[model samples]
Target: EAGVTQFPSHSVIEKGQTVTLRCDPISGHDNLYWYRRVMGKEIKFLLHFVKESKQDESGMPNNRFLAERTGGTYSTLKVQPAELEDSGVYFCASNYGQGRAFFGQGTRLTVV
Candidate 1:
């Protein structure tokens, strides 16, 4: 079975533009998370999803960002009006509620 997969490995957009990153986790996993790393800093948790419901999203930077896991199958993170500070590698991970998580090849986002 496939692990986690992220689309459009890289994206470059002008400031105030919008970008959406997608992630498909391994089938049957119930826990999903979105993370970000800016300028080599440690990965910061953005949100967590249990199935199709958002379990936690306090880590999200602001209202300009949105995340969703539809039907508990796949997830998407959208950054509207992208800002320079938002430039970073966005990571997606999933697990069966415990232990090591399976990560996707992060989507590198750059806002010019």
Candidate 2:
């Protein structure tokens, strides 16, 4: 029963560069979700994946951002040509029908 894990903890890049974030959910869990909060804004949902299928991705901001969960295990989120506004804490959460979800420490992306 490993907890969700994220990579890099923090990243700083130029306005036009690209960055990729990773997430590893707990074992035996089928639900994985990506979320973030920017500049005092509320935590927003990015997408949801159940197993190898994407259950929902309507929260994705634009084409510049992409998310994938391969083999229903760990997931990845890539931001291409990043922007300053993209600077924020990216969190990955997982739930297995449990009332509470586990979250990673989060990756703080700082696009300058």
TM-score winner among the candidates? 1
Tens digit per residue, CA lDDT, model 2, 29-88: 889999998979999999999887889999999999999888999999999989888999
Worst ten in a row by lDDT for model 1: 93-102
Candidate 1 per-residue lDDT, tens place, 1-112, comes to 9999998799999999999999999899999999999986999999999999999999999999999998999999999989999999999999997868999999999999
Question: What local lDDT score does residue 79 receive in model 1, on the 0 to 100 scale?
Answer: 94
* Clashing residue pairs, backbone N/CA/C < 3 A, model 1: none
| Every model's TM-score | 0.96, 0.95
Q: Residue 86 deviation, candidate 2, in Å?
A: 0.8
Stretches > 4 Å off in candidate 1: none
